[model samples]
Target: MRILMAGVSGFLGTRLVDLLVADGHQVTRLVRRPPRGPHERQWTPSAAQLDPALVAEADAVVNLAGAGVGDRRWTDQYKQLIRSSRVDATSTLAITIAGLSEADRPEVLLNASAIGWYGNTGDRVVEEDAPPGEGFLADVARVWEAATRPAEDAGVRVVRLRTGLPLHRDGGLLKPQLLPFKLGIAGRLGSGRQWIPWISMSDWLRAVMFLLARADLSGPVNLVGPAPVTNAEFTRELARQLRRPAIIPIPGLALKAVLGGFAQEALTSTRVLPGVLNRAAFSFRLPDLPTALHAALHD
Candidate 1:
């Protein structure tokens, strides 16, 4: 399959590109800078600019473009960037796909989303059908997913990937914690009761490939593991894996001071389940936290 993707330099994107290439799939990257190679095409998503012909050449389009939510402290400016970065990229692709002739449009669009859509679900388990929750990330996710309507309405199959925390030593949820955990200074955040819907990096990559080929599936799909763990459990397991003592717990106030507006989100309990993937009979190699963590830390 010929796949045109945005945000190719991101943690997931970089690995996805490699996986696709290894599987003998043709991947075209939409880059912000000048074309570095034949596989890359320049696109300015901030300005809603993309060549329609680029969209015309692919069997599918994978949009992983967005600002990193945890990359920096959430100042008002940074918050705006977080929202705009996702909305603009998604809107650009959706609108571009809508403008194309039916025959010219790609077969499907796999747009990146997050489980943050369900704000503070507490103990309540959420699925793809759950209603939108309240919070900054929720609001962004609502619009972010909505941005794909243009393509969806234009007869293109659109899949909103409401991804959970992907476990890996390289990036995502596990990277930052590795150093502190290795130093035996890491512990749960705040109350540590919040549920973390995490997936292993290998499973995450596999799920994407599964969804890419599953033409019958569309709309919101939770890309999380079957078992969701509380922050306390996560802390304990991580500490055990590293043979570290998780005695230093960080207070919510400290997190707020450091992460700014993102602190509340960090403490959010979104117990999301991959309902769609489960029903579709998609198998997960590492379905539980222990196996997922071991694979992440070891591999």
Candidate 2:
């Protein structure tokens, strides 16, 4: 399979490309900066390229482009940047691809989304059919997914992957978890009862490829572990892996004081479920919390 990727430099994008290439797939990256490698193609999000010939030649287009949710301090300007970055970039990609000749468009447009769309569901079990949750992140994700509907309407199979915390040591959730545990400060966040829907790095990408291969799989599919863990439980397991004591859970207000608006995201509940994947008989290599925590920290 030939795959075109946007935002190839991101955490998930970088890993997903590696997995796809190792699976012996031809990969092309649409990048913002100067083209760096043999497979890199340059395109600006503001003035994106829209060559039909380029669009039609690929088997699939995997879009993982966007501003990082956890990276910046959420000043008013920064919030706008976050919203504009994802909404504009994704809209451009989808509309451009949709403009291609019907024969030239890729079979699949696997767009990246987030479980944040469900907002703070408390303990509610979130599935693909669940309505969009409220607040900033949820609003951003709703618009982001809506941007891709045009591509789906144009006879291309569009899959919005509502990905959760991808547990990997190299970047993302693993790094922060490490610092706290190393200093013996690792503890549950907020009330500790908030469900933290997460997935192993391996399983997350594997399922993406699975969706790409299966013609029937389209729309939103929650990319989270089948066995979701609460923050308290997740904290205990993480500390267990590092051989540390995970007591004295952090207060939500304290987190809000420190992280401001972003605290709600890291400390609140999502409780997403991969219902479609389970019903389709997909099996996870890292099915439980302890084993996944071990791989993330040790291996």
Candidate 3:
């Protein structure tokens, strides 16, 4: 398959592109710089523009493009940038795909979203059909999902990947979790009872490929571990995996004091399950938190 992806330079994008390429698929990277590999292109998402001729030549379009939510401070402007970067890039893709001639258009569009769409639901079994939660993160995810309307309406199989925390040592949630866990100071974020939806790097990659290859699957699919562990459980597992003492509990007030609105996401429970993946006959490589944490920490 000839696959085109925007933001292939990001954490998940880079891994997804690597897997796609390794699987012998021809990947066209949409980057900000000049072409560097077998397939490379350029685009500026903030401006809502891309080379149409380039976009028109693809079997599938996987949009992993977006600004990182955790990369910036929770300032109003940064928050808007986070929302616009995703919504705009997706809007651009959907619109461009809609503009394509029938014969030249891509067959499927696997767009990236977040599990944050469910917000802080404590222990509730949220699925694709669940009503979106309310708040800043939820708002960002809502608009992100809406961005793909044009593509879906144009008859493209649009799959919104509501991703969970990916366990990658080089980057992602693991990087931040490392220092505290390694130093034996890691504890539950707040009370640690908040459900932290997560997926191993291996499972994340495999599940994405599963989604890409499947024909009947579309709409919102949660890219989360089937076993949604609580923050306390996560802390204990991670500490045990790293041979550290899980002490030093950080209260909700401290988290809020330090990170403000961002702290709510960390302190609240998003008890999400991989309802779509399981029903679609997909299997996870690392289904347990202990094993996944060990591999992530060891690597």
Candidate 4:
């Protein structure tokens, strides 16, 4: 399949692109820079400008464009940026695809979303059918996923990937926590009871490929592991892996002071389950937290 992807330069995107290319799929990246090679195409999502020809030629379009949620303090302006980066890119792609003739339009569009859509799930095990939760990230995800309406209305099978916390060695949620946890200065965030839905980078990639191959699936698909662990459980497992004592607990106030609005997300308990994936019998390579941690650190 010839897949046109946005966010190819991002951490997850970089890995996904490599996997796609390795599997012999024709991958064209929509880059902001000038076209540097045959695999690159120039486009500016903020301007809503992408050549329709590019959209028409692809078998599928996977949009993973968004500003890093945890990269900086979430001020009002940064929050708007986070929302716009996703909604704008998705809207641009959806509109471009919608304008294409039926014969030329791609069969499917996989748009990136997040489990933050469910906000703080507490102890509730929520799935794709759950309504949007309250908070900033939830609102952003609602608008972000809604931006794909144009493509869906155009008869395109659109899948919104409500991704969980992906563990990876070099980058992602695991990397930042490694140094602090290794130093034994970090422990569970807040009460340590907030349930965290996590997945390994390998499982994330594989599940994405699985979703692309399954024509019958569409709409919101929770890209998470079957088992969801609490924040305390996560801390223990992480510490155990690193052979460090994790006894220091960061207070909620401290997290809020440092992470701003994103700190609330840290204290959030989203016990998510991949209902769609499980129903479809999609298997995860690293289904458990300990295994996922080991793979992220050693694999």
- Highest lDDT: which candidate? 1
Deviating ranges (above 4 Å) for candidate 4: none
Provide C-alpha RMSD values for all models, in order. Answer: 0.6, 1.3, 1.3, 0.7
Q: lDDT per prediction? A: 0.96, 0.86, 0.87, 0.94
Local accuracy of candidate 1 as per-residue lDDT tens digits, 1-299: 99999989999999999999999999999999999899999999999999999999999999999999999989899999999999999999999999999999999999999998998899998898999999999999999999999999999999999999999999999999999999888899999999999999999999999999999999999999999999999999999999999999999999999888999999999999999999999999999899999999998
Each candidate's clash count? 0, 1, 1, 0
- Name the Cα RMSD for model 4: 0.7
Give one digit per residue, the lDDT tens place, for model 3 in 1-299: 99889888898988888899899999999887777876788787778778888768899999988888777568888888888889989998999999988888899999999998988788778888898998888999999999999989989899999999999788887788788888887788877788888899999999889998898999999999989888888888878777889899998898888787687777768989999999997988899898788777675
The ten-residue window of minimal lDDT in model 4 covers 166-175
| Ranking according to lDDT, highest score first | 1, 4, 3, 2
lDDT at residue 115 of model 1 (Cα atoms): 93
Clashing pairs in 2: 56-104
Worst lDDT run of 10 residues, candidate 1, spans: 178-187
lDDT of 1: 0.96
